[model samples]
Target: MDQNSEVRLEDAGDGAYEIVGTRSGDRLGRVALTGERVTVEVVPAARRRGVATAALREVSRLTLRDRERLELLIPWDNPIALRVALAAGYTREGIRRGTPELLVYSRLASDSGEPAPRLLPDLPGGELSDGVITLRPLGEGDVDFYTELHSVPDVVATSVPAEPKPADEIRRRCSRAATQWLTGSRADLVIVDTATGLPAGEIDLYYQEPPLAQAMIGYSTLPAYRKRGLTTRAAQLLALWVFAETDIVRLVAGALPTNIGSQRVLEKAGFTREAYQRQRLPGPDGGRLDDVQYVLLAGDLLAQASGAGTSHA
Candidate 1:
């Protein structure tokens, strides 16, 4: 069949069908019938199981019961099909070796007595945050607070590249943050001072992949709002929300070695110094500089929160 061959089986009967052959709701695949032929498509992370064969068997039954001829087109060089098709009652009709090679397979649906496969539930979003800071979705109004926070002189001084950015540049950064949040690569929130009804700063939780569930944490505070423990309070609140709301397990933060103030904020927020890397970060003035890494695991935050409660009285 050509690329435009709408070989989807929906028009044949109930519009759509699915076959799930594994417990994880993974190892699942589907087949769509277009006119008289069946097109097989595999689901990711669920491949290699018998999902394809099971789906084909179900489709074959449907075709045979409907008294329609069954046709399937396989790539000429696909070795996997050479084994699966023969085992599943399919026979090689002929081969068309053109610009794009095609190997056609056919099967007879005589009895049409095969049992249909079952479907599975959708994957859950996993654990939501713990309720401390409330890791909610970012909105357009957050741009103003983010812009003002990043423009603060102290924040600029402590940033990887020490130079303060212009208002336009800060706005551009906020715009990018908004895009990232919308795309699901990042989650951001305005740090609202619950008591004052004003935005104090911003917090971002970025998913860094390959490890399944990890994230990087970053925050900034406005100049007039520093030294009053707002950042620390916000961080603590945010950390609680992150652990409770998201599926993330590890949160990492990086800072210049000389920035004791930043380090203190992190420590106060219950993060632990994990490691130090020399010349790993760039200096604000110029050249390369050393950096210290801090990490706060979900367990650590839970422990700290419990400890703080005990000491409060």
Candidate 2:
């Protein structure tokens, strides 16, 4: 079958075009041109193929010839869509908050007319595992567990505000976590008990830039899962992922001096104490709190691997 002939575009008026696959007689999707932004969508059935990419290429060729900039807003949770955009040569520029959330990707009309250099890395797939615990990407199924995690008094007091959060807000954060992976801005991993396959906690890494050469790490464990060495194991796996998967130079974390638990977790994860800042963070009690900083470097991980006489495999 001639795929090119099967895929057709129709002017939908108002600067919009309808994409249809003639062979299937399915309205695959639509594209809308508004100012410098170009939005494209493919029917669910046609997704993950070359449909969207082909449509985007045609759009770029015809519509973007005289355009200096073309932008695509992809929901952070929509990794498939982000992949399509990336394949069609879009560079993630920044993040924005809204319903469903979004990462802004754009391409510039350059003198050479070539695609932009890929600024975002492919989303981490599969799972990172240590001997005792495994860390995987958070998903919608984790909403209830995540909510329960935040509801713990100690967790609320140390991580988020002391006040109760609406259910909607918790859900929004869960969705954002899924999208953060695609945006290359953050990776929130659900720490699972390897023996039971249940969520024990979560760990997060937030990148500072597209280079993703440095990041800040954070974590929380469920009340029932604490003190079993789960969080420490999870942190180690995350540190290993950062050092092995990306170009990260260092991973950093901060804790209130009063939160001895977090400090110990960082230490156990091989993060060296970096600094102590006075009144660095706001406390729940409306007072300033001292912050203790910790860091783990790629070199440190390598040294540890060498000391153990094992490859960092």
Best-fitting candidate, scored by lDDT: 2
The TM-scores, one per candidate, come to: 0.52, 0.83
The C-alpha lDDT values of all candidates are: 0.61, 0.77
Report the lDDT of model 1 for residue 231.
Answer: 67
Q: List the residue pairs that clash in candidate 2.
A: 76-179
Residues 1-313, model 1: lDDT tens digits: 1233222223334434554443334335566776666677776654566556656665676567766467677763353554355445666567667866566767766633333211111112412223322333345446666666666777776665777677765554554544344223566666655556577666667776625677777777676666767667666766676676666678888877777877888988888999999988777556887888999998898888778352110
Q: Write the per-residue lDDT of candidate 2 for residues 61-145, one digit (tens) a residue.
A: 6776787888888875677777777667777788778775678888776523344333234436688776678888888788899
Candidate 2: segments with Cα more than 4 A from true spot: 1-27, 75-77, 93-103, 111-125, 160-164, 209-212, 308-313
Global CA lDDT of candidate 1, please? 0.61
